[model samples]
Target: MASRLRTGSADMAPPISSGRGPVLWGCALAVLSIALGFGCASTSPARFPSGRALQLNVPYFPQQVGLCGPASLTSVLNYWREETSVEEVARAVYLPQLNGALGIDLTHFAQKKGMQAESYTGSLLDIKDHLARGIPLIAFLNLGGRVFPVGHFVVITGLDEAREEVIVHSGSEANKPIPYQTFIAAWEKTRYWTLQVLPPRPASL
Candidate 1:
């Protein structure tokens, strides 16, 4: 099967878009960057690590234009069994004037859809813990400089200790492997911002 495809439940409804829609298009200045700003990713073949590793099945959506936030969120939402499309996610989160979406908007979108959403400055240990539990996460990376931040969102799926790489659904690729050093260099810019969607709890017996 193609990487982007994933089997899901039949009742998945796209989350309803809400609030003022896009945030105010204020600010006189704007940071310039490429689509999704996945500058840390390279088109090189990943050196599959032989050491400790873990991976989870997550959906993938090729981001159109600067909609990495929507695309990345779609993957995680689907992983939580809340299947949705990038377009549907964009309606709730995309900030056209900025050419991308913000972390706040994405989290709110998930919450409005009745999802258990959380965003924070995540750690490497945190990532491993979540992945071990079969949960994938969304990460915001500043691939630009301190003076000008070129941001992007990618779904993190696994960690390869031997090669020091983190498997992610990035850019136009799914389950792509990026070096830990490279990923962290950009991730640090945003203090390792992470977004997670947890599965609903079981009902009382």
Candidate 2:
């Protein structure tokens, strides 16, 4: 059977014109490298370790137009042992005028729901390590080709070293294996923005 590829939000800006030449591509790559460097510099190596394969039993929530943020959060929260619905999350994270939710909105909403949430920038290796440690991540991906004209949020649930793919719970699909390079390129458009929702720790008394 063909792989089930879930689509993202339709509220993205229009795609870039195809007329741009190699010059634009070169500049974009340079910027991406610099962005990756700056983003990865602050992450501690001890927190993210290399891994071969890692998968977690994360639930799936198919998102409607502009509801990807809430849906992705619902999956992550569910995996963290919280019973949540997309509707409940949407009520807190979704912005009616923008037709979508920002990363900050999602973080704040998660905090209100009693989950510890934080936003950060990291590399693919960092993501792989987090999955290996059983931490599912929510990331902002630029599905817009040529230029980053569109953005979508997804849950990173697993990684396969042999296949060189990252498994994601995207929209309505579970275990979608996106090619490593393909996923990285799209993720780089957003400078590898990630939101981590950690379970609350017991009180230390």
Candidate 3:
């Protein structure tokens, strides 16, 4: 079973007016993972689907047993490596041990495809800018006190321009992808995450 943690109303950060404005939770999650050392090289591989496609076709799996939460990190990783594309990788959450693996996998994939993997430590606004450019961002969040004291992992996947919400795929929770609002709320409490920029795949490679 996954550990559940509670937070008081006082914990919430003042909402930012713009989607690109400051994001407490999202940025926090990005920094903690810290996808470093992995070379950011580009190989020009086969084209992969975009964020919109993955969000619509996200498969539902029953939460696993004996881990932190419902979804199993292993299952998510397998899906990323075998079934899903680079876009889908942004929307997954793995258990503690697998978080590092996820980070490494993403960093490696970005480098392999010639995508730019950047480190955004201070400003989430800059991070969001990268996302707008179709770059995949990784974040590190401290889930100890706010969302769930037990701590957790999550990936930021999609963004809704009209609603100004950030879409995310979180594992250890359930089969469903996390909505923008919910992701923002949970992320604010943990304000430490990293952002990686994934560029468009070259046509000829």
Candidate 4:
């Protein structure tokens, strides 16, 4: 089951307008499990050519601390050829009380905007596979350290098998390379939730 966080009530103040905002704050309802092992999970040699990295030109948007949802969504939508803004997406999916968007909310909003959005849990290979097929995906992560527990969203745009890292557009940081295992650890905190957004399918011939 997906975790939940309560930031007071649905009647809380509306989302802020203007400025890259503060990282979102929320109380997690479930303890995230980080027991997934990464042993023997090296990148597949065949899937990626030796020493060759895959990266896409995903747009970047710096996010206010609590606005990663909208910012990340904006990046993905724009990559799929949709012209949208974080503010517009914030209006559609932002929950002031929760201070962040649920994966389901993001998926719904993308679908409503005529994109093909799907949420699933998969291995790093799956993500690399998507990238190989010219698809980028959104990953839910825990950015907080031992002192703070925070939730974040990022867009995966590339993979470097040589470095065993994945490139992501992370909150104003474009094409940041995170070690594959490190990403898995952070992503595991959110149950490995991933969102795939694709352009609308064409009509049958």
> Model 2: runs farther than 4 Å from truth?
1-51, 145-148
Which numbered prediction scores highest in lDDT against the true structure? 4
lDDT per residue as tens, model 2, 60-156: 8887778888899999999888999999988876776656776777878888888888766656667755766778898877777533345678889
Model 1: residues with Cα > 4 Å off, grouped in runs: 1-50, 203-205
Tens digit per residue, CA lDDT, model 1, 15-118: 23221121211111245322221112112233332358888888888876688888888888887888788899888776667878777778778888788786
Q: For model 4, what is the alpha-carbon lDDT of residue 43?
A: 26
Worst 10 residues of 2 by lDDT: 21-30
Model 4 per-residue lDDT tens digits across residues 14-101: 2222322223222232233333321121223335444568888888987776678788889999988799999998888777766776
Q: What is the lDDT of candidate 2?
A: 0.67
RMSD of each: 13.0, 10.5, 11.0, 12.6
- Model 4: how far residue 72 lies from native, Å: 0.9
lDDT of 4 at 3: 24
Cα lDDT over the full model 1: 0.67
lDDT of 4: 0.68
lDDT of each: 0.67, 0.67, 0.37, 0.68
